[model samples]
Target chain A: MTDTWLTSLITDTPQQGYELAITLSRRGVKYTQPDMDTLKKLRPEYANSAEGLTAASHVIAVNFQTVAAANNYWRG
Target chain B: MTDTWLTSLITDTPQQGYELAITLSRRGVKYTQPDMDTLKKLRPEYANSAEGLTAASHVIAVNFQTVAAANNYWRG
Candidate 1:
């Protein structure tokens, strides 16, 4: 569910569970708690997979960083 | 600057400032201060247009809300 939502944020379309997970992983996206919960629900094996962790870090560095920066821009 | 970054987040590609402004408008994305600043820099005309405000609200509703929810999940 969360994967689909996140994928839609990027792709503007809903994707299958596994496909979205793979996509997020391949993109090196960070995982928020909701994302992790959703991943565990949808595919527990992939939730903590090597690829997933890598993607999570990447997401934090790239996407979340941007979001945080945007927030900072507003707070200031 | 902000629009391009946000677009890159979604498209994974950099787009023309004008093009990205139009795209975000159509998508109904919400604007953070950074987004507004970037939009003003790229195309001030579009920043407060009906479409832009709508998009900004939409973005906040759909995207920011998710991010906030994810944050809450983590905080818990």
Candidate 2:
């Protein structure tokens, strides 16, 4: 389900996508906001997977580092 | 995964969470953007379910109607 959301965020449309990418760096999860252009260039495996997409619609679609950051950000 | 992101978006530490609520209204899927205050008062069962959240981190939590709108918006 999560993957579906991320993939949709990237694959559903090819125009200017709205993404939040904070992972590129630590642990847990990150809040990634990848733009449409960047989204187009990203590999499916790297960004969102088929199973993941099948699972849900909306997803964070980022590395754990960003997830943790976002969590911390919200907490703070 | 999708739900996790959204729940995090809401429950983790919601100050002013970012949500896209398109579901409450049509088909396919909707894009929703519900605010934090509202989120604080919403019932989790209705907003972000445990399974839904477990599925993904960034799911577009909305009624099917909003999903179609967002999809159309992105497609067009």
Highest DockQ: which candidate?
2
Candidate 1, superposed: residue stretches over 4 Å from native: A1-76, B1-41, B73-76
What TM-scores do the predictions have?
0.24, 0.19
lDDT of 1 by residue, B39-67 (tens): 33534433546764554444333333333
Worst lDDT run of 10 residues, candidate 2 chain B, spans B24-33
Q: Model 1 over residues A13-49: C-alpha lDDT tens digits? A: 2112212334443444334344666544754343323
lDDT of 1 at B48: 45
lDDT of 2 by residue, B1-76 (tens): 1332232222221212223332211101112223334334433533466664443233333222232332333333
Among all windows of 10 consecutive residues in model 1 chain A, the one with the lowest summed lDDT is: A9-18
lDDT of 2 by residue, A1-76 (tens): 1443232222121111212331122111223533556545643433233232322223322222233333332322
